[model samples]
Target: MTNRPRIALVTGATQGLGLALVEGLASRLSPADTVYLTGRDAGRVARAVAGLPATSAQVRGELLDVADPDAATRLARLVEERHGGVDIVFGNAVMRIGPDDDPRALMDAYTQVNNFGTTRLMRAFTPLLRDGGRFLVVASSLGTLSHLAPVLHDRFDGLSSLDEVDKQVAAWRDAVLDGSAAASAWPGFINIPSKIAQVAAVRALASQRRDDDLRRGILLAAVCPGMINTPTSALWWDVSTAASPAEAAVPLLDLALDPVDPGHYGQLVRFGRALPWKP
Candidate 1:
């Protein structure tokens, strides 16, 4: 790592996986560093920061709603002004809805926060990342290309820019909204496509920024923490045997703080292994 003071940020950090990530960063980073934990609610953000264990690293909170198109850019500007640049950023803010929920009513909001909102965060903070920085998105295992239709493989695999990814995701969203999605052509869970879009954005950006990332020692990857027993997981699976957020956080922390790995850049990773885009 560079000698410059490290500054990190985690969005949706009021509780569960996001909060656990904030705690882990505090424990791992030196006292000289700072970690910003953000949530939509001011009270929750304040409480989350206040509840963290005493650690060498400084912890603070900020109010952020990833769904707000401008919130991320505003925060990015603030961080830039205060610290010059950011060292680590985790795109963890998300929305979860059950299969029974009304897709017509919730689909737009869900896609907005989980897909477009995340892409916005990446765009906003990536420019301010310092040398040797790491940009990681807490995506899901459902994001694997194997979950999508075979016909869609080339489109996702060939995505070379964020705009292309956005267009693809928008096409998917438009199809769902228009009731034109062929049955079984996509995963039933609405979350899958959103996750896929988020991971694809990582790949596209990684490709776009390859030279700069290599020159500056920056690493970018989307990680699947897997079946964590958070409220989000409870919506779709039995939590009896699921890993707690803290346990799931172990590998994620390693990915965030470990030495930069070129092989993992632009890949969707699970347990430190890169998943094949097309399975």
Candidate 2:
């Protein structure tokens, strides 16, 4: 192992799974590593950082709103300046803007935060991510092909590169603009489509980066934490079946620190199990 310090950055870490992920990562940090916990709210970020267990790895709070493209750019620059590069990146920030009544409006809002924002972050940080590093996107099972219309599902399954993923997302946006999305069999839940975009992005990135990842020992994948008892999920889930944020974070933390077979790359992991994307 290199003697250089390990750096980790987690977005939307003020509460819920993000916060739990921060804590879990901090608990395992060596003295040479640092975990940066970020959120839009400065006070909330401070509080979350303060609550972390005392550990050898330093925990710092960063103010960031992933929805702003410039913010992602700045954060990536800041990490590069301070640590030279990052070892881990968790794209966990997401927004469930509203119900599906206005499909266009809901689509726009979710697309801005979950899809566009996440894409911006990955673009900004991928350069800063070190070889052999891990990049985990907090995706959801709702993003699976089962929830998509047959045409859209086939398109996503056939994605061969990141550019194609962008094209597919653009096509969906056009469909939404023309009122075709609502008429189609695509699920009405805005979160599902947003997550579908996120997972597709991860898959595309994994494919595009395959050569580098294999040569450098990097791991990239999307993970579903299940229905967690967070403010976001409280909207629909029954309290009894919902898992605590800490409980849901278990798989994420595992993937972050463990050394896995190269086969794990590009797969969608749910509850610690890697599910095949293709039949």
Q: Quick one: best TM-score, which candidate?
A: 1
Off by over 4 Å in 1: 182-184
Could you give candidate 1's per-residue lDDT for residues 128-225 as a string of tens digits? 98889999999988787888788777757768888888888888887777777646386656777888888889999998898899788898999999
* lDDT string, candidate 2, 129-209, tens digits: 787788899998877777776766776775766667767777787788788978886666767766777888888888788
> lDDT for each of the candidates?
0.87, 0.81
lDDT of 2: 0.81
- Evaluated with lDDT, which candidate comes out highest? 1
Please provide the root mean square deviation of candidate 1 (C-alpha atoms, Å).
1.4
Q: Clash totals for all models, in order?
A: 0, 0
After superposing candidate 2 on the true structure, give the runs of residues whose Cα lies further than 4 Å from its correct spot: 98-103
